[model samples]
Target: MLATAVESTSAKIIAGSDDLLAEILVRSPVSSLIRFKCVSKRWCSLISGHHFSLLHTFRHRRSKPSGLLFRHKPSLHPDATTAPESDFELVQLNGGVSTAPSLRYFSFIPGQSSVSGTIILQSCNGLLLCCSFPFMAGTRRRYYVVNPTTQQYIELDPPLEDGTSAIFLGVNLAFDPSKSPHYKVVCVQITLRSLYNYRIWIYSSKTRSWRISLESFAAPFDMVFTEGVFWNGAIHWINPYGASLCLDVDRECFRKMPEIPFHQSNLAGKSCRFFGESNGHLHLVEVEGPQTTQFQVFEMKVDYSQWFAKYRVDIGGVVAAFPEMIHSYLDSGDGNYYDFSILGVHHEDDEDESLLVLNIPGKIITYNFKNGNSKELVDFAPAGKDKRLMPQLGCFDIYQYSETLAPV
Candidate 1:
């Protein structure tokens, strides 16, 4: 039996077979091995070894373990001249003992640019997606996608020339192991010109060129990019503007997934944005309307459901605060989360004392809905007390990853 073998091997590892035993032990069920690590120091060292960590990362889905990227709020709105993003830090959210995030690391300096009122994000696969805040003067704004993990960035040219109103970009990062480089971007531009123009643009890393996607959706209002997350080779978005939509990058297609099942119908109040992936499907976190506006997560089980309620967010007894009109759900996955200042991290709290001013109770929070349970991750600083409001989440959603699945 597997148990008999596990017990036998558990007693027989020699000094010279560390690598072999480590590999063998890693092959065992993770929960079982993790339990054995508690049985003795030798097992602890073996399980927590660098090789084991790398193997776990290679086999299972592990966000860069560095920690969650804590985003800060602007004192006067991002557009204000006085409150430039002078410095920002990263806070590793510890889930073992407490949900409270302690400052573990940081990047102390001005964020990528001096421009005020820009969108900021800690993307999955370890990148910070950002853009300059728009001006009333109506100048075309610039955008940047920086991967702090690699210290590399792509500053996109101003979005499709929307000379009249405003244009915002949301990008999804996908990697196709089948391709040479395997990374692709699905950038959707939400612009209000004569109508709600839902334009999807794509950037192929292998081709090293950007092109207009053949796919377009009929959005009711301008579209907004959900958090740029990689799930089953597509990017997802919360379409409070129309029906919820998802874009597939490899196939270059548009399809409407299930909508969040909140009780109310007024699209104006529901703050639904793409959060992260859960159990291999896309998730939309919605700040439900009117009644209490509590936050909830809706999981899409079937990619093409034509609007069905898949699963509900099971919050583990924490207050599900709604997203302030100015902020939305962010997709910052541990190490590879949103990084600013050309990039950012989470370290000491006092390292960036300004963050100390950010209250953990307000602003926005992260929700994890798995195993029929939802747990609150981090509570960012509130944005209303002394401040000007910036364009937090607006007509942008779904960054599709171009990566393909291996042979079934």
Candidate 2:
């Protein structure tokens, strides 16, 4: 009788230790945690709680991105019959193990009968900013913030003041669970009054409403507002001509970004090859002259004072291995016909492990800066009729994917 009583007490002690159970559960992947909800009512409550989700995100905030979403641009040919059959492909980074959910998982969203109608605009942390457009020409596009891992989503209606005549510029997603569990979506639209002047609309998940910024601002004539990157609490818009813009969401104000350290004459010929944020770092890659194999990766300072040359990459070796990267019909004077696009720059806690993800003629490769080693991560049929890398034609749109349990 005494032994039986002791066994019951031990079982009660083990089962009552929720803190220990939470520690173990936090270490599990989001998928495992979802399945664990079925273990018991207490387990479900703990796993589905907001505080636990925030803790899970904080614990894995520094981990590397799970993979990348590669969206191929549709054919620019006038007579092309249809868009690419696949909306996007997931390129797993961690030993080919994919943790991020597929885009098709969004089928549960209301009115989303087909994945083809929805397009992913931005991926911040784990939430995806997607747009659902109607087949009819005059219908407005619907926006959504979705957590694919949890399959939680919220639809956002267009700003009340957004008129049909307003020219839609772009939208950006900002969510840092380390700072707060809430997320915000910023939408920019160009006003018809002037080409340079634009309006800003912001949506807060906390209030579940949209509001326009009190002030209107003008941007550089050449600024491409469509491609903004969210980093350091601001949405940054880069202009190759040295004029850049950033909107601080916390302060709800607009400011100018530091100029690229290059002479006007030098800047005229260079093009922005890559601009993105990963692991709390913002990097920019620019290529000049006729050699695309050699370029410098620039890192923006946390103070926003300047950009320094963080890494100098010479992928001539990549060119030598894949001769198809060399353009056959076109030459830019110097006979250096290298062709490639910098899809992303992934920074690791160990600098030696940092890598540059590149898209070449017929393959996707990762180039390690420390050792100048290149490895092909994926291969596909060469793009376009010329079988050339035409990034300027919008051939590829890449976004870093990280797994998070943050509720939408």
Candidate 3:
């Protein structure tokens, strides 16, 4: 009877401890989950299991904005007029901070000491797709998919070329941890000889291979391929000159989106526009007038056949609120009214939220539409504290990123 009672008590204790472990695993971040794996054999199995990863991703699906990723080459040369080299450096400014934000350099590249020719392409979920510089020279380029947070990465073979002089138009990373651990990378390549012909290639992590699409579409010469967004099961790219193209990731098909209805008077003979995605809907931001503070935002309907005007924010008010930004713009004397690009929406879960991220020339600023408040997030001054290099203006690229555990 005594032995039976003792066994029963031990079983109860183990069950209770497991219940507590499950609670913590679901709530912790990816960084903590990785470290917790070494705590015990049970934790190593549970935290690294496929099912546990899905559970953790779902629990924080609505996570707040975390940081902004920047890729640029500092001007290391003595002459300011001399162009910066292709050795781009990646940095991040923490956006999730409750106090003052801080800057962090990307220190987790695989074989950091010797790797070169790497270009940061696009980010999806938490993974980044990077390519080597040789691709631009009409040669095959190796691609690297990396997750900086967990310091894990995988390399992909170069896409097959048919000797048509293909140019890598863009790449879009697609990942949803709730669905599966496997991820996909879609690359768009445009032919220089046949200006109208475009090619699509996709790489799957599960298969560890590249699949080329047999479809072809007419593409414009001024296509905006660098800043493509993956949304609604498709990768979309918009050129500021009133043209948009999308590729369905699963079907490997291409289609055109509805033209943006910007009034000629508002455009003032210039096609200054930006594209962004929020809550699974594509957004188009256009300048309303020259030297005017008002800007218009339009959202695409579910059918993707039409667009509806969503919100109009007085951007001039936000800029004026910050005298420094106003002085900086006015001092430039460039007279370009549309000097900023709408990055993305922030604080989406709150009904009273009207915060939008704006990318200025040398810095990023957060503007709240509801209250017309503006604050600077990062300043990319030419001469940074690092004595070896000074960042140049033409090569800066920024993206709003959220924390995720989606593997490469």
- Give a tens-digit lDDT track for model 2, residues 1-408: 999999999778767998777887999987688899999999999988877887888887655577887654532221122323334567875434232335553567876644335667778888888776555656666778987777778888776553643335788898877677888988887776787888888889888887787447888777866678889888988777767888888789976668876677887678545788988889887788555667899999998988999999998988887787888568747675666777889888897889988777766778998999888876655545445644432323567877788877
lDDT to native, each model: 0.44, 0.74, 0.61
lDDT of 3 by residue, 1-408 (tens): 999999999767764686566766779877677788899888887776656666677777655435656544432211122222333223333243222112122235443322233556666666677654441233455567876655556777766568433346677787655455677888777755487787777778889887777446677777777777777777888665667788877777776678777754445554336576665556777765345567667888767888887766787765565433333344357654445556666535453565667665566677775677777776654654531123223222554555666556
What TM-score, over all chains together, does every model reach? 0.51, 0.85, 0.75
Tens digits of per-residue lDDT for model 1 on 107-133?
211343444444554244434455555
Q: Weakest 10 consecutive residues, lDDT, candidate 1?
A: 399-408
Q: Using TM-score, give the best candidate's number.
A: 2
Q: Quickly count the clashes in candidate 2.
A: 0
RMSD of each: 13.0, 4.0, 6.0
> Over the full model, what C-alpha lDDT does candidate 1 score relative to the true structure?
0.44
Query: Which residues of candidate 2, in runs, are more than 4 Å off?
Result: 1-24, 35-46, 49-51, 72-84, 94-101, 113-116, 162-167, 332-334, 382-396
Model 3 residue 26 CA deviation (Å) reads 3.6
Which residue runs does candidate 3 get wrong by more than 4 Å?
1-24, 38-46, 49-51, 58-64, 71-107, 113-117, 133-140, 162-167, 178-180, 191-193, 264-268, 288-290, 327-341, 360-363, 379-396
Angstrom error at residue 75, model 2? 9.0
